[model samples]
Target: YRTKIVARSQNNKMHTIISWSIPLGNNILLSYIFAYGLGNHINITSILLPTIGILFIALGNYMPKTQRNRLVGIRIPTALNNDINWFKTQRIGGLMFVVGGFMMIGGGFLGMISEFWTIALMILPLVLITVVPIIYSIRSSHKA
Candidate 1:
């Protein structure tokens, strides 16, 4: 299904690049965390949380580069309707992603202090990242 979507999309190359990179990076980070964290008795959550944040940051950097397609990105209906909306949404979404990434990274550090804070930080940013972009995309679409 994904292959067909990418194959048909105008920016197939970027989609392909992102698809390959996301998994590869995730695997590498997970592998290292398990190998080193377990051996050294380091808290896996502490390391894993930050690693996930860094991944989000990398993804955020790529978000604006993506073109409208079903294979990757936010994929909201409003953004998908037109190129201008897609572009604006992607740019805003990218920023939100980066901010969320930083929040996650902070959550990693706070994980040592309180589980509640760690969970809150992690979830709140995720919600904002998703909801904010969709809202912006929808409102922007209405205006246009």
Candidate 2:
């Protein structure tokens, strides 16, 4: 399988792999190793790392650019019918996703709020982002 390392940021100091193979076993093994390394020092952040890693792996495989319209990707009907609308909606949605992710991640770090509340905050923005584009696409389509 093909593989490549991508650096997200200089400060982050972590590299993500773009891989064609399913590395579920490898991931589990790595998680175990990390957990063991942090034995007796386990904390919320340690737990969050694996959760975020899983999310990143899943998202990498199911990104909008890769799965345009099956079921998981954006599915605004009007946007699907019009390339320009599709591009615009996806770009906007992508930005919303990044922002929501950051908020959720920050909330995790803060550890003051309940996990459910943090998740809700992330979800609400995503839902709004999705709705806005769909509404705009429909309105624009009607005008055309």
Candidate 3:
């Protein structure tokens, strides 16, 4: 992929620059940085960094809202087994992500959690929430 910029002045002067490389999608890099608690101190940056990263990750993973048996979306085997279940699972997962992200962001301001625990606090609920739908979908599928 390549990006280019061109600018022209009233004096008829022009400047052009072109860059070529795979775009480092912000989510990919931010997730790594947030995973490491890069800006995680008892400060604004601490809360903002991870919150932004999580939001990007959530948005990027669940865009276009199509039902699919893919790895990134709601991939409950049962959900993938049917289109309606897939849609419902994805919607629920997306809502869970939003709630989880907000919770983590709110938790960041509390200052009671140590940096280490903050990372865990932010991640664990999301994992649990993500898992619930899969488990439910499986059970529901099996029952059917």
Candidate 4:
């Protein structure tokens, strides 16, 4: 399914880049998971949380390079309107992703406590990472 999305991509370069991102991201995520031999005695939540985190880090790293485009990055209209907003949003997003990745690694440790807390640690950081940038872009645009 993901391959089809990448193969059928339209003229938008960012769209194409972001489209290919998923499969490439997944490869990285899987590589990290297996690199640890977690598969030998896998705790499902422990493995899953870190996998998502690694991918978030990769995507966030890529965000700043996306430029303003309908098909990628934070596509909110106000953000797309200015390069400052776009880059600022991406920078913050990248930082959040890196932080979120660490949080997920910590969450993997928490998996021994309970799956709920493990999932929460991973997901909350990601949610905050995504939402804060959007809000920042919108508010900054209003100020301008």
Q: Tens digits of per-residue lDDT for model 2 on 1-144?
A: 111212123212112233422475466557767877878444444345335434543443333342234233356687768766665666556555555555555645544446565566556645755676677667777877
| Number of clashing pairs per prediction, in order | 0, 0, 0, 0
The TM-score measured for candidate 3 stands at 0.54
For candidate 3, the lDDT comes to: 0.54
- Relative to the true structure, candidate 1 reaches a TM of 0.77
Q: Candidate 1: lDDT of 82?
A: 97
Clashes by residue pair, model 3? none
The TM-score values for the models, in the order shown, are 0.77, 0.50, 0.54, 0.69
In the range 1-144, model 4's lDDT, one tens digit per residue, is 764355335324545545776787678567766865754555766766776777667777767766655656777777878988888887777788778877887798888898787878977897888798888888888887
lDDT-superior candidate, 1 or 2: 1
Q: Is candidate 3 or 4 superior in lDDT?
A: 4
lDDT at position 5, candidate 4 = 57
Badly placed stretches (over 4 Å) of model 1 are 1-41
lDDT of each: 0.81, 0.51, 0.54, 0.73
Where does model 2 exceed 4 Å of error? Answer: 1-73, 112-117
The C-alpha stretches of model 4 lying farther than 4 A from their native spots are 1-41
User: Model 2: which residue pairs collide?
Assistant: none
Give the better candidate number (2 or 3) by TM-score: 3
Better of 2 and 3 by lDDT: 3
> Per-residue lDDT of 2-22 in model 1, one digit per residue for the tens?
756663576654556567767
RMSD of each: 3.5, 8.5, 12.0, 6.2
